[model samples]
Target: MKLFLIGYRGTGKTMIAKILATAWNCEWADSDGEIERRSGKSIAQIFSQDGEASFRKLEIEVVRDLATGPHKVVSLGGGAVMGTENRTTIAAQGLTCWLQATPATIAQRLEQDSATKSQRPDLTPLGGLEEIQTVLDQRFSVYQSCADFEFDTEGKSPNQVADEILVTVAKEQKMNS
Candidate 1:
C-alpha cells in the first residue's frame, strides 16, 4: 500500500515522506512537484496562471497516477484532499498520516522555508498567521476525517515524526497479521 502524507503546508509532509521512503526502502513522490514537472511550471505559477480549479484538476490526475504502483510514500499538496475524488482515491489506495501543528508553528515554518514564498501562492488576502488560522479552521475537520494516523509536528524533528509513523505502521501491520 502507498503511504500518503496529508496535511497543511509547512507541516513537513514532503520532508517526512523522504525520511519514510528511505526507511521503508521504497520510492516516493510529491504530488505538487509532479504537477509542476508535468505542467512545466511551479505551483505558484499554476495558481496564478491557470487558477485553483485548473490546479486541482492537475492534482487529481497526479494523485491517481501516483496511487497506481508498488508501495511508496506520497506527499500530497495541502488542499489536495478538498476534492472528493482525491480523498476517495487516497482512502481506497493508501494509508494517510496527517501531520498537524498550530497556526503559529506553521507560520514560523513557512517563513523559514525560502521555497515556500516562491513556490506556493497565498490562498487568502490575509496572509501570514491570520491566513493560516483561517485556512486551518476550514480544513481541520476534513483533515481529521481522512486521517488514519495523526501526528503533532509542533515540537518534533522530522526524523522523530517519521520514526513514530514507522512504529505505528509496524504495529498496524502486526495487528492485521
Candidate 2:
C-alpha cells in the first residue's frame, strides 16, 4: 500500500516518513525535494521566480508522476494539498496519514530546524506563535478532510510516531486483506 504523509510545515512528516519507509522496506521521497530536483530550483526560488501558482502546477505534475509507481512512503510538502487535483489523486490512490500537530508544536519544531531557521515565507513577517497558528488554521480543514488516518505528534519522537503508523498500516492491510 502506498503511504502518503501530509501535514503543515515542521510537523515531522519527512522524518517520520523516513522511519516508516525503513520499517516497511519501501522507497521514500520528499515532494519538495522532488520538485526542487526536477526544476533545478529550491522551493523559495520557485516561489520567487514562477510564483506559487506555477509551483503548484509543477507539484501536481510531480504527484501525477509519482502516483503511477508502486507502493511507497511519500512525504508531501505542506501546501501540496491545496491543489484540487493533488488532493483528489491522493484520495483516490493512497492512504494518507495526517500528522496533526498543534501550531505551538509546529512552530517550535520549525524554529529548531537548522536548515529552515525561520525562513518560511508566511512566518517571516510576523514570526511568532500567533502567525503560525493563523497559517495552520487556514490549512487545517483541507488536511483533515483528506486524511484517512490522523496522528497527533504533539510531543512524541519520530520513532514512536513511526511505530504508530506501522501498526496502523499493518491493521489496515489486514482489514483490506
Q: Pick the candidate with the highest lDDT.
A: 1
For every model shown, what is its TM-score relative to the native structure? 0.99, 0.93
User: Model 2 clash tally?
Assistant: 0
Please identify model 1 stretches exceeding 4 Å from their true place: none
Which ten-residue region of model 1 has the weakest summed lDDT? 168-177
Q: Candidate 2: give the clashing pairs.
A: none
lDDT tens per residue, model 1, 67-160: 9899999999999998999999999998999999999999999999999888999999999999999999999999999999999998999999
For model 2, the superposed segments whose C-alpha errors exceed 4 Å read 117-120, 123-125
Clashing pairs in 1: none
Shift of residue 165 alpha carbon in model 1, Å: 0.1
Against the true structure, candidate 1 reaches a TM-score of 0.99
